[model samples]
Target: MVQVIDGDTMVVMKGEESVNVRLYGIDCPEGNQASGREAWIFASKLADGNPVEVQPIDIDRYGRTVATVHVNGRSINEELIRSGHAWVYTQYCTNDFCRDWLKLQSDSQGARSGLWAAKNPTPPWDFRHSFKLAQATPQSSKPKAPPASAASYHGNISSRIFHDSSCQHYDCKACTATFTTRQQALDAGYRPCKKCGAK
Candidate 1:
């Protein structure tokens, strides 16, 4: 049996030990990124509580087994690409098998399926690289100042997401609608954003 950790990672019970496996030749979006939760949900539906056969390729630097997984003869990695939930990891995929995987991604893109539905979707690798670089760079060497008290809720007319004044997305150029209270935002037909948990 297998338990999905995310779109591209899983934990499998091997004998008495649990083994961490990273799906080979595919990279999914990060957890906090756009469509990241959707990818995870799709992957969970495919893998959770299901019996999967893993073909180990190598071990990653993080000690996760890099492998190809099959669930009832369907290649999970290929399926992810075909379904537009993941990208074929060209940098790490050097084998001849990658050609077919790349083709699958192209087909999905042409059909505008899944992540391809977005006009421009950021790849997980690029997102991770940018995140790492931001972590390494400091905004200021001086001591950080405490944030002010959060104000009442506000809503973005375009996005239909509501948050308090201190929320990251609050009061942006698109957030034209103002609410005196959280309930007012809800009454205005705005939902809480997952990032700030407005409700």
Candidate 2:
């Protein structure tokens, strides 16, 4: 059985188990974004209960199997682009064939179909980034006291990395663990996060 989660996400049943798949190389709008519902409807028709072949690309931090999905030997990824349901996610799309997906997106944008019907469609990546920034932004305009540690360091157990409290990533969701000093993080086998100037 194939189940549709959203425009670019789905689950395929294998007897007693199932696999969660995220379509690779393309990014669709969020569930609440403009034309988001339309994209889901299109994707549901393409993959719902239909046989598909997934080419595993990478496992994201969220543990989603990112891959290109083919339904009835047709590239669902390409179809989404050709119909303006998604944009080429160039950040992680370094493969040679990604160029074709980009071209398809360009054509779709020119035609202003589906999500492209909007004069300026906001990419889902940008939307998520803005949302995260909003969520991570402190609610009060006034500043709060920093971690009572002598030294200023923020640690994330999941990534096993530490960031300078002055760094923008310091108060990220994963960075619940605080460190008094850089040495304290190093002693705990936590390295510095590259995003921040943790050297």
User: How does each model score on TM-score?
Assistant: 0.70, 0.68
What lDDT tens digits, residue by residue, belong to model 1 across residues 135-198?
4576667534333322356565446688764477764665534444566567545798888897
Which 10-residue span in candidate 2 carries the lowest summed lDDT? 143-152
What does the lDDT come to for candidate 1? 0.75
Cα deviation of 146 in candidate 1 (Å)?
12
lDDT of each: 0.75, 0.75
CA-only RMSD, every prediction: 11.9, 12.1
lDDT of 2 by residue, 1-199 (tens): 7766557776666678677678898888865467666777798889867878888999876566889989999998899999999989999889999998888888998888898888888998887688558546885676664554434565664576888756888767656344445665576457898877564
Q: Candidate 1: how many backbone clashes? A: 0
Question: Candidate 2 at residue 19, lDDT?
Answer: 73
The TM-score measured for candidate 1 stands at 0.70
Clash number for candidate 2: 0
Off by over 4 Å in 2: 140-199
Residue ranges of candidate 1 with Cα displaced over 4 Å? 141-199
Clashing residue pairs, candidate 1? none
